[model samples]
Target: MRGFGDLEAEIMDRLWSWGRAATAREIVDDLQLRRPLAYTTVTTVADILHTKGWLRREKVGRAWVYEPTCTREAYTAQLMHQALETTSDRAGALLHFVDRMSGDEASALRAALEQVKERDTP
Candidate 1:
């Protein structure tokens, strides 16, 4: 899977933060706070994300509203899996990654693993 470009990431961040479908105009207005961006530019990027299957769009009134197809957690997990695939020793890489996690993150990882274990144990 292709990674997101700078603009794509920014747009996705806004959509995720908004937690709902948003129009190109709304996204442009929100993004303009950080940098000057044209409405068409945002629209083009949103369309690209839709083409990439990272976002879904619907016709709301005369405008297209876009929202993430998956949650942020799912995206993060995909990235982690991709990173792991790059290494020959997946177990060592994961151990090193776990060693670097903060206390809270480690606890969350443990809990998430337990939940997965329980779900898999038919």
Candidate 2:
């Protein structure tokens, strides 16, 4: 969240969702909001992702196929860790975050945790 741009987020989502390597054109095709972007733009973004250590690339034929280096959950956890590193008041920031979530969101989180616990225990 913190280290990503709009395009980066979109591209990462596409790569992670596919769970496979993809070229820039392949990434562009998955975008729902169709916009005229040159192939260079996508390549540049993919390169930037690689530079940021969020993506890994492999040359395939004439194109470089890119894939996410980390899972979505791992990336999110890293972002949270970065946030904590930046904040002096970690407890206060966490309290504020919990305060902002709606009751339904809290319940959903609890349910997800319970499911994970059940799976882990049994």
RMSD of every candidate to native, in Å, equals 0.9, 3.4
Model 1 scores worst on lDDT over the 10 consecutive residues at 1-10
lDDT of 2 by residue, 7-93 (tens): 888899889888999988888776735776677877898999999889999998988999899999899878878888788999999
Tens-digit lDDT string for candidate 1 (1-122): 65789999999999888899999999999889989998999999899999999999999889999999999889989998899899999999999999999999999999999999999999
The prediction achieving the highest lDDT against the true structure is: 1
Return the lDDT, model 1, position 28: 94
**Which window of ten consecutive residues has the lowest lDDT sum in model 2?**
29-38
Whose TM-score is greatest here?
Answer: 1
